[model samples]
Target: MRTNTGRLSTRRLWALSAAVLAGVGGAFASVTTGETKATTRADHFLQARAAPTTAMPPTATASVTTESPATTAGRPVVSPVLPFNAKLTSSDIPVRGGGVRSGACSGSLIAPEWIITAGHCFHDINGAWVGGKPRYHMTVTVGKLKDGDPGGHTAQVVDVRQSPVNDLAVAKLSTAIDDVVPLTLPDKAPEVGQRLRFAGWGSTSATVVAPSDHLKRGEFSVAKIAPTTLEALPVVPRTVENSPCADDSGSPYFVSGDNRTGNLVAIENSGPPCPQPGREIIARVDILTDWIRTQTGDTAR
Candidate 1:
């Protein structure tokens, strides 16, 4: 599969996107050829739009493209500040043989010690999926209202595993996060036209290129569903401003429930520039429920 990269005014969102898309707000965070974090909390469901009628083939590439170091695109954190947000990034995500990569990313806690994110977040210099250790120093921060907020749990990422079928990946944290409840994985697939919610860390819009520390949560409707991916359009505001931006990779898309908890179904991958443009191409997680269970110790119902 071949992936193409896009450029922005200031920051480049995501990494190596074949132009498809979901997650917390990522797998969208564009690494400045550089780096990329954020979360998803669904508290409300707003109005939605009809699904796109066009038939789209599955793209092998998952997110936008990772370009540099601290300038990655895509936003992750999206909220007033709560748990469940797994902000992802590495000082240098090592590629096998040689070279290193760094960037911002977002994810959702699936278990006491596990977080799920975009597989492309751990790719090699050549864009091939990488496994085993991630981040020369991988750190996951939860519940940070602002970028520099210290009021959250930070854990060490020990192991990284990529899916063979889709753009999903799981990380094993050194310590278990006992405070926040992990997002749920539903067995049912998301229907087209369904309105789902998301919260990711990102710049407010394409024009607002600087990464924000605050979580940006909003609602969107599913446009189309594929075997392993889906497309969504911004629905809450139903404008380009409400759409997911370029940086956050692995931000979650979920069905919101009571008390901020939600169902994990898909993650942010890639698409056009934020605040406007094409539908988002996201990786579907529902298809891999069983495998994620096995990898993360079967999250209790």
Candidate 2:
């Protein structure tokens, strides 16, 4: 598995190497390679800095990389958490083949139509994988905090399913969604240092590309937890920046301690250029919780 293409400056972040790691935002975004054709536009981007690769082992690959759209470098939560605040937000289904929706990528809400994100944000733009059973649609906004904020609650995916190993996926919305509430997965996982808790809407700037509708959060710890994948690292030190950026790719890494606490484990995948600091990776939802309960059969509480 080897495919590499680069552009991502004006907002064309696309980089998939070995097995996983698509850029743009939720799978990142932005695409317009050769033929001199360029019209990709989607604000919430992410992607840059993948880290794992021993020649690609771990079943085959599944290193989890794809980031480059939306927004997420942290900073905004003045008082978030209100209506169904399990945190959710995603966008990238503009379809045209390659992708380019710019911003939106941050989810959590285990079962209620399943949420989970980051299968390269459902591919597109040449990377393929657009979300089974679909006519090109990916929207998951719920109780939003900014970006138009009217009470939140959008949903319209249908199906996605991706995680034979890691960068994980779940989609399947278009129905449930009323009061949020779903996050609670971690039966075992997350240790290295513990102290997680990261939400997202993305874009706080680690280089520029801005895209934050609000719904932000910070706090990092778990330095490394391999098994499927995990990174964290950022208790606030790297010159005061925090971590997780570039549309925060499928964001949702929580487990505040106190005995399970918020639970959830990890989701976002790809980091390092955000707000300056580093280490973010994230993907191990407690070993995928029985592969997300056989793909959203929901039971692994």
Q: Weakest 10 consecutive residues, lDDT, candidate 2?
A: 35-44
Using all chains and alpha carbons, the TM-scores for the candidates as numbered come to 0.68, 0.29
The positional error of residue 188 in candidate 1, measured at the CA in angstroms, is: 0.5
Instruction: Identify the leading candidate in terms of TM-score.
Output: 1
lDDT of 2: 0.54
Candidates' C-alpha lDDT = 0.59, 0.54
Model 1 misplaced regions, further than 4 Å: 1-82, 93-101, 205-210, 237-241, 299-301
